[model samples]
Target: MFRHKGKGRRYSHNLKLASILSGVAGLVNITGVLSVNSLTTNVTGHFAFFSEQLFLKNYEMALIYLLYILFFLSGAFISGLIIEWTTKYKPHSSYIIPLSIEIIIILFVGFSPDLIPGISQMIISSALLFAMGLQNALVTRVSQSVVRTTHLTGLFTDLGIELSLLFFHHQKARRKQINKSIFLKLMIILCFFLGGILGAFTYQHFQLKTLLIPVGLLLFALWYDRLLIRYYHIKRKLR
Candidate 1:
């Protein structure tokens, strides 16, 4: 799925990529809130909480919230750096490296509770935010900004604009473009909702162990991408 770019990238590829990643993201976001008492998927809500805490003179929590935002940014920065470093020798590795890093981080996070106590929600929140940040960055790069799995604000905005074009646009080609965008965006949104349902249910029963669910999904993406690429190379050699 990460192998193509621009016009070479297909709607089918984007749909699969968005659905799986968005579903995993939804699981992480809700599960993080349930486990850590903070949202891990996006910084917008944290920024609001930071402002509120600042106004109330709760300086300690305000700083923690500020760290939440920074950690998320740092994760993106780190992933971007890895991409740049890998692209020097293997262009495709840009996506692979960041993705592999994200998977490792998620693994650590999933099992961190084994040694790390549950008393520090802030620490756990930052870890999950970093993982999310890495994922959001990786998806943004691979999709060339066509999709973002972690947040729905911009997706909904684009959906609204596309819906407008689909209904009222005069140009046939423009309408076709709008139609494709709407379908892919809708699939991502619905898949995310489905992920949340799964996360909530798992959390209710298994508690923090629910973190393992997303790890399994992410590993699937990693394995699938790598194996598919390898298969293509072998097929090309035979030709």
Candidate 2:
């Protein structure tokens, strides 16, 4: 689900990845908030705080928010860097590698609550946000920028436009397009919501261990894609 460039699977690889990642993202976001008392999946809140702090001339707090935003950007940058660096050495491993890194980051976050329980909230939030940034970039590159997972800003906006078309536009040809768009957005939103619920309930009981839930989802996707690719290659060779 993290590789290839086509209408993969039944609907499309982009939709598949978008659905899975969006769910994982929603899980991380809600659990991160409960753990760190902050949102880590997107920079929207941080941007507002940054601007507010800057306007108030609170350089210290403003700088903190600035760094937080930069950390998210750094995650995206690092994801692209890892992809490019590995591309030449391992052509087929581009997308998988960054996801591996995300898995590692989540693992760290998961363990932090226990192993390093005293870690600062900001530090934890930064790490979670960084993972989200990496995910957003990886999905964009792998999905050819067709979807994003970290936040629903663009998804909701597009969803609204598609909703209007699905309701107002009666052309059969265009209706299919509207239907597809609507399905994709709704799938993401629903998966995200379901993941959020799982995250909330699990975090309530399992605490930091809840992160492993999303990690498991990511690993399953990575492994499934690899297995599918390998199976295809084997079949081709046999033929």
Candidate 3:
């Protein structure tokens, strides 16, 4: 799912990608809220908070909010840079660095909360935002922008537009494509919701350690993809 791009990609690949990554985003989103009372998956809310602070003349708080947005942007920038740079030499495994970085960040925040001062809020929130930014960029490039796992604002908008298109008459081919898109979007939303529920439930018992669930899922995705690649090569050789 992560390796293929353009015509090499397929509906099933995207479906699986959306399911796993969206779930990971959901877990991170909920865990961030529980840990620091901030939306870590996207900067939409942070922009509003920043503007509000500026309006109230709270420059210090506004600067903090601005930093939150910058952290998310930096994550995206660094992930994209790493992917582009590595794609030149290692196209198949270009995603590894960013994905691994994301996993490590979440694991570090979860495991060493007490080791770092102010881990409860600022640091944790910034780390998660950056991690999510990495994930969002990685997946966007992986799927050629066909999938977005971190936030639902755009998903809902796209879903609504596609649903309305269904009401209009169209060619059979276009209709089939639209149906596939709707299914993919719905899967992303459903998985994200499920992940959030699991994250919240686990947080009550495990606190910030709840992030381990998403990290485990991501690790499984990595392992599963590698296994699939080996199986494909073996089958080709046998043939």
Highest lDDT, which number? 3
Give lDDT tens digits, candidate 1, residues 62-108.
Answer: 99999999999998998888877877888765787777777777667
Ranking by lDDT: 3, 2, 1
User: lDDT (0-100) at residue 101 of candidate 1?
Assistant: 71
Off-target runs (Cα >4 Å) in candidate 2 are: 6-10, 167-169
TM-scores for every predicted model: 0.94, 0.93, 0.97
Q: Estimate the overall C-alpha local distance difference test score of candidate 3.
A: 0.94
How does residue 223 of candidate 2 score in lDDT? 83
Which model is ahead, 1 or 3, in terms of lDDT?
3
What is candidate 2's local distance difference test score? 0.86
Q: Pick the candidate with the highest TM-score.
A: 3
lDDT of 3 by residue, 1-239 (tens): 89888888999999999999999999999999987899999999999999999999999989999989999999999999999999999998899899999999999998866667555477888999999999999999999999999999999999999999998948999999999999999999999999999999999999889999999999999998898889989999999
